[model samples]
Target: MIRGVRGATTVAENNDVEIIKATDELVKEMISKNHIAATDVAQVLISVTNDLDAVFPAAALRKIEGWSFVPVMCMQEIPVPNSLRKCIRVMMTVNTSIPQENINHIYLGNAVSLRPDLKAE
Candidate 1:
C-alpha cells in the first residue's frame, strides 16, 4: 500500500542555511515518527511560502545518507492572502502498511497553528 505523510515547519528567515536546516529537521521528524526508511519513500513533495525562496527544500533530503535516490520536488506554496509566512511544507509518499489514521503528520514551530488538530504530542 501507499500512503502520504504530511509535515510542515517554519524558518526564521529566507536563507539557504535556514531553509535547509528546517527542511532537514521536518523531514527527519516525519520519518522518525512514522518509522519510515528512506527506501520506503516513493517521493517527496515540498512547498514553501512565497516569502521563502532562498533554497529548494529538496536539497536537505539529498543530504540524507540513504536518500540520494529518493525522488524529490520543490515548489512554491499558493500565496493565500494573509496566510502564514516563511513556512515550508512537505508531503512524502511512501509504501507502507500503516493505517491512514495512524500515520503521523508533523507540524513544527509556528506552523503548528496551521494544523492544531494534527499537532504531535
Candidate 2:
C-alpha cells in the first residue's frame, strides 16, 4: 500500500550548508525512523518558507548514493502572518505494509513545537 510520511524542519540560517544539513537530517530521520526502504519511496515533495533561497534543498539529497533516483521537488510555502521562517517541510510518498499508526512523523528544530500532540518519547 502507498502511504505518505510528513516531516518539517527549520534552518537557523539561509546559507547553503544550513539548508542542506537541516534537510538531510529531516529526510534521513523520517526514512530511518520508519525503516523505509529506498525502493518503497515513490516521490518526495519539499516546501520552504519564503524566507529561504538556498538554491533548492533537494540538491543536497542527490548527493546520497542510494537516494540518487528518488524523484524530489521543491516549492515555496505560502506566506502567512507570524508563520515560521526558514522552514523546510517534506511530504514523502512510499509503498509500505505498515499501518498509518505505525508510521513516524518527524518535526525537528523549531518545528518540534508545531505538533506538541505527537511529541517524541
Candidate 3:
C-alpha cells in the first residue's frame, strides 16, 4: 500500500540556512510520527511559498543519511491571495500499511495556522 504523509512549517526568513533547517525539521517530524524509514519513502514533494526562494527544500532531504536515493522534488506554492507567507510544505509518498486516518499530518511554527485542525495540541 502507498500513503502520503503531509507536513508544513514556517521559516523566519528567506535565507538558505533557515529554509533548509525548517525543511529538515518538518520532514524528520513527519517520518518520525509515521514511523517511516527513508527506504519506505517513494517520493517527497515539497513546496514553498513564493517568498521563499533562497533554496530548494529538497536539498535538506538529500543531507539526511540514507535519503540520498530517495526521490525528492521542490516547487513553488501557489500564491493564493492572503495566504500564509514564508511557509514550506511537504507531502511524502511512502510504502506503508498504516491507515490513512491514522497518519499524522504535522504543522509547525507559523504554518500551524494553515491547518489549525491538524496542529498538535
Candidate 4:
C-alpha cells in the first residue's frame, strides 16, 4: 500500500542557509522516524509561507543524497491570518506497507504549534 508522511518546520530566518537547514532536518526526521528509505519515497510536495521567499524548499530537498529520482515540487502556502511564519511544510508520498496510524509526522520549532495534537511527548 501507498502511504503519506507529513512534516513541517520553522526556519529561524528567511536566509538560504537557515531555510535549507531547517527543511533538511525536517525531511530527515520524517524519513528516519518512519524508517523509510529514499527509494520508497515516490514524491515530495513542499510549501513555504509568504515570509520564506528566500529559496525554494524543493531545491533543498533535491540536495539529499540518493534523492535524484525523487520528484519534488515547491509551492507557496496559502496565507491566513496569524499563521506561522518562516514555515516549510511537506507531504511525502511513499510506497510503503505501513498503516496510516503507524506513519510518523514531524513538526519542529514554532511549527509544532501548527499541529499541537501531533506534538511529541
The candidate that achieves the highest lDDT relative to the unseen native structure:
1
Give lDDT tens digits, candidate 2, residues 1-121: 9999989999888989999989998988898888887888999999999989967999877976688899999999999989988899999999999898877889999998778676543
Query: Can you give the lDDT of residue 46 in candidate 3?
Result: 95
Candidate 3 per-residue lDDT over residues 25-117, each given as its tens digit: 988889888999998988999999999988888999989889999998888999999999999999999999989888889999988887777
Worst 10 residues of 1 by lDDT: 112-121
Order of candidate numbers by lDDT, starting with the best? 1, 3, 2, 4
TM-score of each: 0.97, 0.95, 0.95, 0.93
Whole-model lDDT values for every prediction = 0.93, 0.89, 0.90, 0.87
Which runs in model 4 stand beyond 4 Å of their true positions? none
Clashes of each: 0, 0, 0, 0
lDDT, candidate 2, equals 0.89
Candidate 1 ranges beyond 4 A from true positions: none
For candidate 4, write residues 1-121 as lDDT tens digits.
Answer: 8998899999887898898888899998987888878898888999999988888877777788888889899999999988888889999999988788878889998888888877543
Model 3 worst lDDT run, 10 consecutive residues: 112-121
After superposition, candidate 2 runs with Cα above 4 Å error: none
Worst 10 residues of 2 by lDDT: 112-121
